[model samples]
Target: MAHQERVVALLRQPNSMIAEGFAFMEAQFVALHEDIYVAQPKGFEDPVHPNHVYKLRKAFYGLKQAPRVWYEQLTQYLLHHGYDRGSVDKRLLVKTTRNHVTIAQIYADDIVFGSTLQKYTDDLVEVMNKEFEMSIVGQMTYFLGLQVKQSSEGYFISQKKYAKNLVKKFELESSKTPRTLISTSTKLSKDDAGPPIDSTVYRSLIGSLLYLTASRPDIMFSFGMCARHQSAPKKSHLIAAKRILKYVRGTIKYGIWYSKESELSVTGYCDADWAGNIDDRKSTSGGCFFVGKELSIMAEQETKLNFSEHS
Candidate 1:
């Protein structure tokens, strides 16, 4: 999915790309499950014996090899059409002829194809339609829950709708807004001996919040801190997590904006807060890479190696 972000960033320049979508289901497979056969569904039974295993000629959703088979099929198709698979990201396929360049990104069934020329896009859609089961999704807008708004100023990616739904899901729509995601003075340590909360509920909340971090990077650290205590989350930890939601409630519309005006430049920022995880005496290391002032990757990891936690 990080490849998905790269594709979107490539489109930041106005008129740099024209996109369309194509997606399909399972592909035909020559290999059988476990190199033998699998039990058929109740209705598609074997005549010899109902208990005997069966074989399949096509890949289906549930099979482990389905994704691999489907990818190989897609790769062969692209190669047959003069496109070269990206050495960096296998999911990316590219075709270039003189000045015209076309790129396609494959994610399971979904495909995002774009080109410098309309003829290339039209040709791709035409051939793909002839070979696969898919239809044009037209110009890219909303994809994978990331609401996209693209124009002369570049793109704005947000999960406002998802965040709103999350607030409602957690019953925090009516909660007070928090000035900060994690209160400055608040501290969450594993050995606090605070009253324990429902582990199942705490985990559920953590999972929901983690998904929201895709667009809400601001709450990433605070929300992730609460996740460490999933095994024994306490009332204090839950309150910290709720504070993040409270902040989200106020800035529900906040999103990452890629400005076209910014010059093309790359920068990286990294830092570590020593002994941030009090319970384990571990520090948190944070790093991010930027493309023309737009953040492309943000990573946070907890490191027990104190030597690597220098300011």
Candidate 2:
């Protein structure tokens, strides 16, 4: 997800355009390399061949090899169209014609592509349509829970709809919103005597917030703190987790803005708290990387290294 965000941030420029689309019958288009047999369906079975299983020539949706064959097929098509697979990230494909470079990133069957010139994007779409059944969703507005608003200045990315759904999913619409995500004075520990909450529910909250972190950097620290207690969440831990939801409810529309005029220089900030975890006395280390004004990556890790061990 961070890689995708970085690509968008770098590709987006003044007067540039980006588009997204998915392949129709994504997996069915590919031919299976290895022979696969399946029991014939009740209505489609031939009377004489009723005792025999059908050998698959094409990939099926539930087949384990479906994704691989589909990916290979798409790769061949893109390579034939003059796109080069990214050396570092295999999912990224790039095509350069003189000074104009067009980039496309693939996630399963969905493809998001852009270029400095609109013509390059259009030409690619045309070729893709010719090769495969393409559903060209012109101008990317939303993809994979992230809402993108592209303008001449830059792109505004957010998950406004997803946030609203999250609030409603947990029936927290009536709950009061909080100004701060989590209280600074709050100290959560595994040994807390607070009543134990359902571990599954606690994990669901953590998992949802983790996905929300893809577009919300402000929640990263607080979210990480609450996630640590997922193994055996207590009432206090759940309360701390709900506090984040309350905060998100208040600032649901908040998002990062990438400016086209901002410099391409990369900047990073990293820090660690010594022996911060009350349970294991381990330190928490975190870093955030920015491309120009937009945050491209943010991560937090609870390290095993302890000050007492070194001492």
Candidate 3:
């Protein structure tokens, strides 16, 4: 059948019948298991004696294919029940009715979804719960490390707690706040003359900062510039990172707010710093996109800019 026809058929059925069908389908796969295996040298010896490699009979957490298998199973189930995958975002599924629209987002085993019609959303949760061993987390608060707050005004998503944790992890909670993430007059380069520091520590700081940039785009450009010198980070680079931490400590509660009154139109803003890099004389460009007033995307690029003295 055509995709639209299939969806119409599913919607025409009584909700109770559809719910029961989903229940039966879920039971069939509840006990299905996949095997796991590990390889070892044939002559490998244990601490007490020689031993052979073992093959696991059931799927384990660390197996590479476990997530893929689970997702395939879930996607098949949803498709069978009339949900159509979104063209723009593969992780999204859409089900539409004459008066209502429903959206379901899949992130591995976790699901975040909503519907314009309360009944449709309620029916969906009922069918899904009947089929799979699932946990409904109520309204989405925190998912995938982003803190979500839904209010009468709209929705607010932030990483304030995560930012605070990052500052504490790096022992920068007590550091003095900086006026800015990066100094406007300062330029960073691969400092060959600077002494080496612990690469592991530098890398860890960079990793934490990178994650923080998800909600804190203000420091994105500075963090990216400092990250480039991770292989040979110097005192200067470390200071720059510490400055970011100081900024975080001072503004830990700052976060993005999405208002209900905001328009859905997408708009973007771009700015560039010409010859921002001292040694390389590279210009840095930064851009942020908004759907209404809520930020939807942010990016930064570093470009080599030629400079010459004029007469």
Candidate 3 ranges with C-alpha deviation above 4 Å: 1-62, 304-311
TM-score of 2: 0.92
- What are the runs in model 1 whose C-alpha is more than 4 Å off? 1-9, 16-22, 25-53, 61-64, 80-88, 96-101, 305-311
Q: How many residue pairs clash (N, CA or C atoms closer than 3 angstroms) in each of the candidate models, in the order given?
A: 0, 0, 0
C-alpha RMSD of each candidate structure in angstroms: 3.9, 2.6, 7.8
The TM-score between candidate 3 and the true structure equals 0.77
Better of 1 and 2 by lDDT: 2
TM-score-based ranking: 2, 1, 3
Per-residue lDDT tens digits for candidate 1, residues 117-163, read 67777888887777777767677887778888878777788998888
Give the winner by TM-score. Answer: 2
lDDT of 2 by residue, 1-311 (tens): 43444455446657678889877575346788888889988888888878889888798666778778888888888899898888768989888777667888888778899887788888988887776777887899999999999888888899999999999988899999988987778877885677998999989999999999988999998898898888789999888998898899999999888878766677899998777888888888999987777787788998978244553
Instruction: State the lDDT of candidate 3 residue by residue for 135-250, as single tens digits.
Output: 55566778777898766566667898898888888888778898788888878788889887898999999999898887787788889888989888998899888898899889
The TM-score of predicted model 1 comes to: 0.84
